[model samples]
Target: MAFASVPNGNNIRNEDKVNEFLQNKSKSMAKVYLYMGIGLLVTALVSLGVGALFAGLFSNFNRVDTAYIAENALVAYITTMVISFIVLLVDGVVIARRAYSSKRSLWVPYIIYAVTMGVFLSTFLIAGIDFYTIGEAFGISGLAFFAMALIGYKSKANLNVLGMVASGFLFCLLIGSLFWGIFYLISPTLVYIFDIVASFAIMAFIMVMVAVDTYNIKRILANGCEGNVVLYCAFIMYSDFIAVFIRILYLLSALKDK
Candidate 1:
């Protein structure tokens, strides 16, 4: 009597399908990183160009006059921030709906967002922050981002809970900061101290958000997402990275002043 052979064909086919899925997920993740890097580069270049142009224009002014110019620059910066915030809100809706049929449609909003961010960030230069402090802040931010991103990629534990906690904390922090700003004239010292503490807290929150966002992007790709999804993921990560960097720079500048 001949024993019946075990059927291994189905097992092999299933293994092949799993491998293919993994390969596609990896490619998608790589694309997300690429887009994020490009977005950052664009922001950096625009910021540098704008900063240099303003610096040249202000080079001939006296100290007191320069202070006046700086005050005006701060107003412009705040206005840019408000406009950028509104643009970001609209962009989020568009990305969620995948409203862009062509690549240009997607790119226009992304580029606008990056340029606005750069214009806002150029205010730091007008504020007279030295190059050394800015460089150190960038370095620290880069290391923190990479470390958190690696942990997010390697860990098996679910990060959804962490993401929720971060969101709650951020909401509270923003509300507190708003109140502090309103009462800042009443107690400048207390408000300044609170601002310092808030800066550190915000940096930590954004770093965790970077990890959470990375994990979410990986999850989305593994679930077979494609098309403009990569742009959306890149935009989220880029925003987180920039926020962390700015907070770090602010904290460093505060410490340096002391």
Candidate 2:
């Protein structure tokens, strides 16, 4: 019995087409970071605004009870951290679903970005933290982030290998920070030493990841992977920015206490 033979040419041609499309898409994906960078700027501005508002409130009140301020600070920190975490989870789910179903990512991350800034601002406002030091923190984070991103996007070197190491270090830092805090050993010098190192490492890692992901997004777009790529890209970008901000805050707070 003669079996019907299908020409493999069609399959081969289809794949070539897909590959070509992905190549073009990768270029497009790279441009998304431009928007992502803008989002970071927006977040920073909002955060600063929040800090300013809090500073003004506390400065005008002129109630300089260190104990009262510290207690309020603790509450603010706890509240913001809790709320930011919840927002992150919710945003992740929403973005993930869209990314999986469609190639186009959504802009829901912008909302998360805004809310995260708000939380941080609230922490300072409620705690009566020093805005001048907070401003220093914001500046440090922003500069480092931009520098790393520029290097990552421009450099010919591949940074994919660093992600694993960076993540491991970050995990250790988290554990150490928690344990040390429990023991009331979270001093300025210790924080400065640990945070400066950790922030540098994370900044490098995030740059590499952002570059790699940007390339991936471009490829997906070229392949006509359309639906939620925007959202996914935004989500990833915001997460990186948040990581940078947190590290900056740690370092800044440490310095201020000194």
Residue-pair clashes per candidate: 0, 15
Runs of candidate 2 exceeding 4 Å displacement: 1-31, 41-84, 102-105, 125-136, 154-158, 171-227
**Candidate no. 2 TM-score:** 0.58
lDDT by residue for model 1 (157-184), tens:
8887998898898899888877876668
Alpha-carbon TM-score of each model against the true structure: 0.79, 0.58
lDDT of 1 at 101: 46
Instruction: Give lDDT tens digits, candidate 2, residues 92-129.
Output: 67767767564443665556655575555555544555
Clashing residue pairs in candidate 1 are none
